[model samples]
Target: MHIFYTPDITQGTYTLSEEESKHCVRVLRLGVGAVVNLVDGKGGFYTAEITSDNPKKVGLLITDVKLEFHKRNHHLHIAVAPTKNIDRIEWFLEKATELGIDEITPIITDRSERKVVKDDRLNKVITSAVKQSIKAYHPKLNEAISYHAFMNLAFEGDKLIAHCIDGDEKSYITDLVQPQQKYLILIGPEGDFTPDEVNLALNKGFKPLTLGDNRLRTETAALAVCFEINYLNR
Candidate 1:
């Protein structure tokens, strides 16, 4: 069945946006009475049938609704530094959404090569991932903020920081993670977090996290954390 992202959906008939309408009526050639699935990205999933196959404004009648569809037990929020190559960060967003992330914030660290991020473009990537993965909830992408500002924000969860600093004892995520709890993790830039930055996070009550012995890139590290958290929850 074809799945469409319809975040504003409510009860009764609904209209697809012009873009989705064209894709449905023209590209997919779906006609009236065609059955399709819709996800509101807020834990609402609907089964609908096309009522008007207009190529510019296709309409549908919602037949069934499911709320809180496939809800996860925990919330995973990753604050990662944007990679110099924008594609890498975008890739991380896509994979993380599929793997189950509740929130994402692009943090700018002292060694970060990329400081600015276009939220609009990155959001589209996350939305596309949500549909592709048949997810009922959309991941929230926060505006890019400096590492210091992110640290000051109040978060009630298992706080962790992943870095490459040596001589500091770091625990594997599997050991520290507790199922059914909120988690906030910080992943630094390519050069990794400066010693001072690490110390600051530690002072803020964030624990050291180690992915493994081998070093990973900024995006890779973020995805690793996403996968690890989802795996532990599963």
Candidate 2:
């Protein structure tokens, strides 16, 4: 079934946007009476049939609505430094959405190679990922913030910081991620977090953790932790 995202689907709202309408009516050649699935990205999944194929606005008559769709047990928020290559960061966002995440924030550490990101573009990537994965919920993409500014946000759950520096002080990420609880993790850039930055995070209450023995790229490390969190959820 073709799935379309319509976040504004509510009482008396059944029209697809101009862009989605063109894709459905023209590209897909779907017409009246065509069955379609729609997601509101806030846990509302609907099965609807097209009533009008106006190429500019495909109308719908909702057949069924499933609220609280695909609810997960925990919330995983991974704050990662944007990679120097924008594609790499985008890849992380796409994969993380498929794997399941509650939120993502771009954290600018002292060694971060990239500092700026377009939240609008990243959000589109998130929505596309959700549609491709057939998920009802879209992970929140927070604005980029400095490391210190990020620490100021109040979060309660397992707090962890994954870094390259290895020692008895660092625990494995898998061991630290608690089940059925909200989690916030920080993944630094390619150069990794400066010692002072790690210390500051620790002082601010983020626990030190490691992904594994081999050093990984920024995107690779972020994905590793994301996979680990999903595993823990399961």
Candidate 3:
């Protein structure tokens, strides 16, 4: 099934954008009456038949529509500093979306290597992951913000901070996470979080948790925590 994305779909006839039209009529060579699927990335999926094969504005006749409900009982939000290698960070977003994440925020920490991020590029990676994984729900992607600013966002769930700081008291994320509960995990940059930053998170009621024995890269740690939370929820 070839599933395309469109934000709006009305009754009778709908048109595909130039990029989608090209894919359907030119690349795929889908003719009139061909079966195609679409998603609005807002919990709506449709099964439609091609009405026109125009490569500039392919038309479709909506045959069936299915409204998908939010499936997960728990929410997993990860906020991490973008890595110096943008590809690695993008990889994390893809894998996390496949593994089922509700939210992602790019944070700017004191030791963060990259301050600016291309939201459009990252959003495309996320969309591809959702389609590839055959998932109806799309993950929420927040614009890049400073660490201190991100902390202020209202989160009605368990909050955690993962850092490489020295502390005798540290619990594994798997142990701290409970089933059917909302969660947010904060992963630091390559240089890890500054002492002041860790203290700030602690003051905000964020628990300090460790990923594992072996030290992991920024992306690895972020993905690990995302998967671990998903596993526990299941």
* lDDT top scorer: 1
lDDT (Cα, tens digit) per residue for candidate 3, span 1-234: 888877777656799999999988889889998999887777787889999999999999999887874478798989999999999999999999889998999999999999999999999999988877866678999999999998787788899999888973779977777889999899999999998999999999899999878899999999999888988988
- What local distance difference test score does each model get? 0.94, 0.89, 0.89
Q: Cα lDDT of model 3 overall? A: 0.89
Better of 1 and 3 by lDDT: 1
Ten contiguous residues minimizing lDDT sum, candidate 2? 165-174
Span of ten consecutive residues with least summed lDDT in model 3:
4-13
Candidate number of the best TM-score: 1
How much does candidate 1 score in TM-score? 0.98
What digit string (tens of lDDT, one per residue) describes model 2 on residues 127-233?
Answer: 99999998999898889999988888899898999887755378886677668889898999999988888888898888898877898998889898889888877
Model 2 spans > 4 angstroms off: 11-13, 166-168
TM-scores for every candidate against the unseen true structure = 0.98, 0.97, 0.95
Give the residue spans of candidate 3 off by over 4 A: none
Taking all chains together, the TM-score of candidate 3 against the true structure is 0.95
